[model samples]
Target: MSVEAIVNDVKTRADVVVTRGQEALEVGVKTLKTANGIVVEGVQELVQTNVSAGKELSTLVQASVTKAKTDGLKAVASNPVAYLPEGKATVLGAYSESLKIVSKTGDELAKTLKSGVETISAKIQGQAPVVAKARKTATKTVAKAKKATKKAASA
Candidate 1:
């Protein structure tokens, strides 16, 4: 089979694994939320901690990608089908590159989620008073906008 086909198969398998992990995490979070009053607060703290730890996870994954690349190349090379005719080497090379690409994609996703969480946490911390104030402000703004639109429609 082609390297692209092999990579697609690997990706499909990885996606299933990731989905299961997310589901397990969700269950844990839900269990914690229901178990104790303190768990709710603790879960929020956990989210903050996880966000901060994202960078570390990204770094670890990057290292893992190096290992995966080597292993993936080896697997491709060892496969009799991958060592077929003319473009076997090229296909194997592409397969190795695909592993790196998938790893990098995962790293990027972690970094993005970490950055977003950090930003949201910082904003929540920095604007505790302002958030409440903004809520009222938003309410009034929406009311006024609705009134104006209604009046324009009538006119």
Candidate 2:
């Protein structure tokens, strides 16, 4: 089955669950959205830390993707799906394929993220010392200007 079909099935299932209780549906959606937001923020922080640590960001991204795929598969398997008209084998096969695609995409993203992190780290590391020196020079220049101004005011 296509990814779209699997997603549609999940949506329908969630709707059915929601029909049982409005509060449950609202809570579930809110929790999922919050989790997604946290994940996005965590990824950004990981990228930034990789730049500072001079480490490859790809490893962190890859690990996260792998975990997400595993969690998704588990959720699909555990979810109640008796309402679907499809045979068990067909539904299971589709879910499995969907999981496989998610894993594959995650692996590719991990590689891309790692490469990007490495590049950013290298650039930052290369420029860090220069930036520090420039800041120090600027600080001294400012101090000198202030001293000159004070002397002039006194005279």
Collision count of model 2: 1
- Summarize candidate 1's per-residue lDDT along 65-87 as a digit string, tens digits: 56556668777567645332344
Structural RMSD, model 1 = 29.3
Off by over 4 Å in 1: 1-84, 127-155
Candidate 1: clashing pairs of residues? none
Worst 10 residues of 1 by lDDT: 33-42
Residue-by-residue lDDT tens digits, candidate 2, 69-121? 66676664676352223334544554565565445434434443343344334
Q: For each candidate in the order shown, give its overall lDDT on alpha carbons.
A: 0.46, 0.45
The TM-score obtained by model 2 is 0.27
